[model samples]
Target: MIVIGIDPGIARVGYGVIEKQERLIRPLCYGCIETSSHERTTSHRLHEIYTRIQVLFAEHSPDEIAVEELFFTKNVTSAIRVAEVRGVILLAAEERGVEVVEYTPNQIKLAVSGSGRAKKEQVQDMVRRLLKLEEIPRPDDAADGLAIALCHINTLR
Candidate 1:
C-alpha cells in the first residue's frame, strides 16, 4: 500500500511518500513545498499548496494520506494559518478519493519513536532507522512528514 504523509504550515508544507511491501515499509520520496511570504496572499498560497498536493496525488496515486493534526501553540495567528493549510491538504486528499487519517503530535511521536514524550531528534532518528535511510531526512519538517506516515503504517501493523 502507498501512503503520503503531510506536515502542514503556511510557509512550507512537508510531504513524505511511503510504500508497504510485504513486511517492509520504505520511503519513496520526501520533501517540502515552500511558498514565499512576500509575493503571495494567504489565500493564493493555500491554492498553490492545494494544487501542488493534487499533482502529488496524481503522481503517487497513494491509497491513503496521513496528516499531522494541529497542536496548540502560543502564537494564535501562526496556529490558525497552519490549520488553514492543513484543511487545504485534507481537501486535496478528499478530491483525489484518497482516505485521510490524522495523528496528533503525541500519537505520532509515540508510534514513530516508542515514546509519546520523545524529543524531535529522537523521532527523526527513529524515522531514519525505520526507513533505513542513510541520514535523517533533510529539513526537519520533511522528517516529521515521514514520521507521520510511519505512524500510520505502524498502526496498520
Candidate 2:
C-alpha cells in the first residue's frame, strides 16, 4: 500500500510518501510546499497549496492519505489558516480517489515514540530510527509528516 501523509499549514505544507508491503514500510519521498508571504491573499496561498498537492497525488498515486488533525494553537489566525489548508488537502485526496485518515498530534507521537507526551526530538529520533534514515528528515514539518504516516502504518498492524 502507498500512503501519503500531510502536515498542513498555510505558509508551509509538509508531505511524506511511504510504501507498505506486508510488514515493511519504506519512505518514497518527503518535502514541503511553501508559499510566499507576497501571495497577497489567504485564498491564493490555499490555491497554491491545493494545486501542488493535486500534482503530488497524481504523481504518487497514493492508496491512502494520512493527515494530522489540528490541535489547539494560541494564535487563532494561524489556526484558522491551517484548518483551511487541511480542507484543501482533504479535497485533493478526495479528487484523487484516496481514502483519508486523520490522527491527532498525541496519537502520532505515541505511535512513533511509544509515548503520547513524547517531546518533538524524541518523535523525530524515533521516525529516523524506524525509517532507518541516516539523519532526521530536514525541516521539522517534513519529519512530522513522516511521523503521521508511520503512525497510520503502526495502527494498521
Candidate 3:
C-alpha cells in the first residue's frame, strides 16, 4: 500500500510518501510544495496548492492520504492560512476518491516516538530511525509529514 502524508501550510505544504508491505514501511519521497508570496493573491496561491496536490495524486496514486489535524493557534491569521491550505489538500484527496486519515500532533508523536508527550526532536529522531534513514528528513515540515504518516500506519497494525 502507498500512503501520502501532508503537513499543510500556505507557504510550504510538506509531503511524504511511504510504501507499506505486510510488515514493512519505507519512505518513497519527501518534500515541500512552495508557493511564493509573490503570487498575485491568496486565491491564486490556493489554486497553486490545489493543482500541485492534484499532480501529486496523479503521480503517486496513493491508496490513502494522511494529514495532520489543525491544532489550535494563538495567531488566528496563521491558523486561517494553514486552514486554507489544508482545505485544498483534503479537497484534492476527496476528488481523487482517496481515503484520508487525520491525526493530531500528539497522536503522531505517540505513534512515532511511543510517547504522546515526546519532544519534537525525539519524534523527528524516531521518524528517521523507523524509516531507517541515514539522517532526519529535511525542511522540518517534511519530517512532520513523515511522522503524521507513521502515526496512521502504526494505528493500522
lDDT of 1 by residue, 1-157 (tens): 9999999999989889999998978899999999988978999999999999999899999999999999867999999999999998888888888899999999999999999999999999999999999999989999999999999999999
* TM-score per model over all chains: 0.97, 0.97, 0.97
Superposed model 3: Cα runs more than 4 Å off: none
For each candidate in the order shown, give its overall lDDT on alpha carbons.
0.93, 0.92, 0.91
Count of clashes, each model = 0, 0, 0
Best prediction by TM-score: 1
Clashes, model 3: 0
Candidate 3 residue-wise lDDT, 1-157, digit = tens? 9999899999999889999999989999998898888836889999999999999889989999999999876989889999999899989999999999999999999999999999999999999999999999988999998888888889888
Q: What is the lDDT of residue 98 in candidate 3?
A: 98
Model 1 deviation from the true structure expressed as Cα RMSD, one decimal place: 0.8
Give me candidate 2's TM-score against the actual structure. Answer: 0.97
Q: How do all the candidates rank in terms of lDDT, highest first? A: 1, 2, 3
